[model samples]
Target: MEGIEQNPVMYDLMSEMAFQHSPVDVKAWIDLYSRRRYGRFVQPMQDAWNILYHTIYNCTDGAYDKNRDVIVSFPDVDPNSISTLQTVLNDVHEQYGKRYLRRAILEEPNDSYDKPHLWYSTSEVIHALKLFLESGNQLSDSSTYRYDLIDLTRQALAKYANELFLDAIEAYKLDDLHAVAHLSEKFLGLVEDLDMLLGCHDGFLLGPWIESAKELAQDEDQERQFEWNARTQITMWFDNTELEASLLRDYGNKYWSGLLRDYYGPRAAIYFKYLTESLEEGKGFDLKAWRREWIKLTNSWQSSRNVFPVKSTGNALNVSQWLFEKYLQDLGSHDH
Candidate 1:
């Protein structure tokens, strides 16, 4: 507690803000032991946000039914309450996620998210770096910190994108490609904004994924690696689960990279089409193989993407550059 009090000016402000906005001052305890300004806070906030969102999404309160011996069921919760809580958590998650995404995108020197007014926080972080520079900290040694911040933010975004993208894919299976599309749009937008964070020189790995997604949507190639079923399932299950190792054994890491290179773009577009079809016809493909292939691709892609500086972004991109510009073009054409 004394150390928290002794912390710098920004920490004080953040703590106060957290307390004010938080539901039960739960955020304060979190802030006390946390480095509120660093990337570490991102995951915790995300976890909290998800718990709140999912709880509200699934819960209901009712007067104790003495006859039934139960207080409530999901059916008992007022829909409005669930919706309201969901909205609150979603708004917070969106704002927080976007704040970090903006910082990574703009390549802000430091990783501070100080301003709440600007809708984006990169400039604030850049301002902090300028202040740090004016204060005359050694540049070479400290420069690594900024770069490290970039990597940290990127990884955080990657973690988020990986999760959401996977969720979107599973949702698509229930004829919910619209949900998948929405998630993919968020993920692609984050990637577009945070492209620099990838540290890939050609950015080829991203390009193909985007392209294949778009192509699949156009029906230009039913066999495209990035077809919705393939891409989405991989992100949801394969990359996120133990299946990654098994997929790698058969296709090798290169196959996954190739899938990422081909599908990221087109999948976004296909997701939209599937969504529309679901709404109009209530019909959608099973996407089983698509899911399996996606698992294979994302498993490899995640490995390479997470390698940090020890891995060369150029080499990683080279493994699947053929689909680079196509993915970018599809992404460029779509709205986030």
Candidate 2:
């Protein structure tokens, strides 16, 4: 929350030197470095500063040996606060490092070049710091100095969301119709879940269910009549084509993989059973039809496998578009 303006001399020198490069003073270096690296972004100065600080003041990196004398020459800035600089760098480093791992499932193909270039939510970074503190990232730390890292990470993450959201929106804007359709379906899934999460009676209406027989036989009530009417239409549709169950089974598997991997193993097995059942009947939707369609679909899926990376440490830098290609390859193999 603190801005560079809090310190007039340091701020002025850094601001001026940022526009021009003269190694005469540390003031010039900080100015140019900050502006060149981060000033283009609206509010990323703090992040830039932490990165610069780490690069310059890192005790273990020999920065202290080369730049320490020049850095101390700056007026109104505490050379002694090198420790504070270290703290900020430590915080960023530890947090980003952990994010590299936690997001591993999303990373594939390769991550070697991507570790240092990641953008982290304030909360995620803070969570990493929390984990570090709890583990005494250094064995020398005091045990009683306890604090919640999640809260800290949350604060940072919240601020970072605007940037992330903007990026996602821009990406979506450039996406093709297939991506838009997928996004729409995902939105619909979330909206449908609201009824259940909010405990609304209408939630039950989202899924398939048979009406009570007595109510069906006796109801002349308008509300009941409307419900029965909707149900009848759906039932007729199902009986006429026998497509709903098959579609549900297929969609359920896709949704399980995308959004509910934790509960998917069992659910996928159940869905597989239903799929097998659907094929057992001498219906049009038999194994022969499945095999024919599967060949084409898996081919398409395989073609997309190169979009992601096969190796990663979950860092954004490591994440690659080539992983999509790999996915397509895997789909082809799986289909076979």
Candidate 3:
């Protein structure tokens, strides 16, 4: 239901699983799909797909975006304030007036955050990319292969975003606002770069979404309202104050081009602004204040009449290769 077509490797695996439910030649069908997905699947592609299956597709604890990316996870003022295991040994202290956080805690040594950050080693994804790109030049211009490569690259880079957040948290704890500021920009830059990269493929672009929404309208006023509806579903999910405090704020988060830059990137920038301010002044960060300001910004974007590019600007293969050089090149070099 989530990105099966856009994710080729996932499409193949899920297709096989559907047959397994009916008791068919699962292994044989799976083998055939290997050849079917890419016309003629080679060993390198198979190896790349195998790594993908084990890492991204291997999740058994059923939940959409279970291993949530750090960007979308709740950014705590104190890294140790919230944890995946939130239980009060006695009375639970509340924050945000129990509106956002009822009783989120991390006793003793914190082992996890509010969200599951990773279920696999990021280094393995780098290895998978190394294998995937080895087949790249040979399969260059194969649009299917290029799209899959972009998907793989997207997963790897998103993990890097996790790393950036961790760095910022460390800097924040150390009272090094400068380092936090730099890391925050690096994080936002990566998201915007991802936006540009995803913009190369029309499937991931946000333009079509707004246009389709407008097409449903009978007038300009209705068109903008429709656009807001389309954008809000993915951005805020719920605009009402009560539901704004809902846990599913970023439940529908995606790496769409306009979305990353316009919504997620700006949201994170606002988060960092308040965070850095608290650090510089030697005071506790104001979560309620930040949420109010963020909500205002989100509301503005939802109704604003802005244009997103309908057509892709760059080639997926070229942009992906450039990103490889920018991010994963060091890993490749170190391996050799």
What is candidate 1's lDDT per residue for 77-165, written digit by digit as tens? 11112111011112222443342221212322432212111122222333322332222222222333333333333323333344454
Tens digits of lDDT, candidate 2, 1-336: 112112233465556766775554553355454334322322233343443334323335322112111101111111111111001112222432333222222333432211111233333333333332333232212211111121222223223322222222233334333443443343333323321221211211222222332234554565454444433332122221312222211211111111121222222223223233443442322434433343333233322212211121121111111221222223322110
Model 2 scores what on Cα lDDT? 0.27
Q: What's each prediction's TM-score?
A: 0.29, 0.17, 0.80
Q: lDDT: which candidate is best?
A: 3
Say which prediction, candidate 1 or candidate 3, comes out ahead on lDDT: 3
Residue 257, model 3: Cα distance from true site in angstroms: 0.6
| TM-score winner between candidates 1 and 3 | 3
Clashes of 1: 26
lDDT (CA) for every model shown? 0.34, 0.27, 0.69
TM-score of 3: 0.80
